[model samples]
Target: MNLSLFDQFMSPTMMGIPLILLAMSIPLLLFPTPTNRWLNNRLTTLQTWFLSVFTKQLMLPLNIKGHKWALSLASLMVFLITMNLLGLLPYTFTPTTQLSMNLGLAVPFWLATVLIGLRNQPTAALGHLLPEGTPTLLIPILIIIETISLFIRPLALGVRLTANLTAGHLLIQLISTAVFVLLPLMPVTAIFTAMVLFLLTLLEIAVAMIQAYVFILLLSLYLQENT
Candidate 1:
């Protein structure tokens, strides 16, 4: 079935992308030259890294200076997550349901994880993927599994987001359609359809938050693994 007139106005990828870009831009705007300023600020390597991560300063809290990197990232996450949940409203479109949006969100995180891991430990990071005590024959198999898991993190992020949003929307549409068709047969079916739609709308709100949490959790785990 065709989407309603309002739904036709919404593009799945458009909303999420701008938010992603907005999030990325925060760091750049605050720290025009993050590498240099960040390096100058600290003696420890970890501190230097953290400084670099926060080069883009977006906020200044009392005496504390805020970095653009942290601000933008937080803003994007909040905005996108909020938007995602909002889309669960009867006819609102969630941009995150699109593949481009999902990829836009996932790719940078994946690349960042790879870069950090390689930078931190070089060959050791690569070698770490293999089990230390495994037999030589088993090393290859284990490495293969590890490699797959590493790659799957991003893949999972994209798929989980797109699938959940898309499926939820489609389900609502299908159920609404069934209700419309059945209404002619019996008035009671129409009421049931209305109730289900209302209930599902509420469920979508929960799903949006759940998916956002899952995305952030995965991102955190990736960072933890690299660190």
Candidate 2:
């Protein structure tokens, strides 16, 4: 039963082709393309407005060098939100639930920020490992600990996203199963469970959006530190 519950996280393949590829591509199509016109449709306008607002907020703390990441970060935010929300639907897979997928997204961006720091300001970057006034004896130990912490950033990013989505999905599934089981035996109890399920669904939706924003936000912070 436990294994079956987790089977949903596995990548689904049909005729030897992974459907996750299709799932990822579908969100791109869902977005409306901008038209070269004075006035655009409401959806496009809303999307543009949201993108502008998000970009502005994200780039606000970043330096000029970090500003270059605005578009990429904005696009990633939209993509992640779409993918997460889509996964909540019936018969859909959430790729972000997979550790490999989340790590794939996290590592490159995190590495880029680290590389930027190393390239542009090596001393400052390396200095993060040690405090301004460290006891001489503790310096090596502090450097080792800080080095480990620095390497763990990407892992934390990936695990945070994967764990939240996985836990939410698992809870939803468990409650939904209970709802069905209790429906005939205890209608009132089932109804209450259904209400809870409805509320949980709403919370999960918020989590879906927030987690994506958080993922991007943390990357931006990392970039800010580097820049």
Candidate 3:
């Protein structure tokens, strides 16, 4: 019998190759491609419309330099949303649930934004470490604290995504297992539990989408600060 509840989070392999790569690629395939014709299919049209609206909203606060990231950020947003939703399916693995995977994504983007700030406006970027009108005695302590907070951004990004996804999945699993075990012993209680599980599943679906959005949103906010 499988004793560990965390086994489901393990990366699966096939023929000595990891399936996480396959899972990541699957979302790209699901996107509808644009046609050469002036008029496109409903699906393609809908996709275009959604993307335009999302891009507009996301880039609203950004300046011209920051707008350059519109396509990259929007693409990442879709990719993440698709992956998170796909992982909700039974028997599918969520790469985002892995702390390492989340960190891999968070660190590079976070670093890029920081670098942009440092390169474009060195004074402004370093100025963030110590605010204006600070007392002389507390200046050093505040700078140290601010520096620590600045470095913590990427770690916060990764942990937030990983912890939210992991918790949701674990809760679903525990509730599902309870449903199965209680069905034979207490049919009434099991029915109520199953109903709760159904509601939780819907909530998880929303969580998956929201977490993806939150991840990108925070990155954009960080970019906004630097740009």
* Strongest candidate by TM-score: 2
Model 3, TM vs. native: 0.97
Question: What are the per-model C-alpha RMSD values against the true structure?
Answer: 10.6, 0.7, 1.3
Please give, for residues 163-223, the per-residue lDDT of candidate 2 as tens digits.
9999999999999999999999999999999999999999999999999999999999999
TM values, all candidates: 0.67, 0.98, 0.97
- Work out candidate 2's RMSD over C-alphas: 0.7
User: Distance (Å) between predicted and true CA of 79, model 1?
Assistant: 2.3
- Once fitted onto the true fold, the runs of candidate 3 whose alpha carbons sit more than 4 angstroms away are 1-3
Show how many residue pairs clash in every candidate, following the order shown: 10, 0, 0
Which prediction has the highest lDDT against the true structure? 2
Which consecutive 10 residues in model 3 have the weakest lDDT in total? 1-10
In model 3, state the lDDT of residue 138: 99
- Which of the two candidates, 2 or 3, achieves a greater TM-score against the reference? 2
Instruction: Evaluate all candidate structures by whole-model CA lDDT and list the values in order.
Output: 0.65, 0.95, 0.92
Q: Per-residue lDDT tens digits of candidate 3, residues 50-131? A: 8899999999998989999999899989998898898889999998998998999999999999999999998999999999
What's the lDDT of the predicted structure labeled candidate 1?
0.65
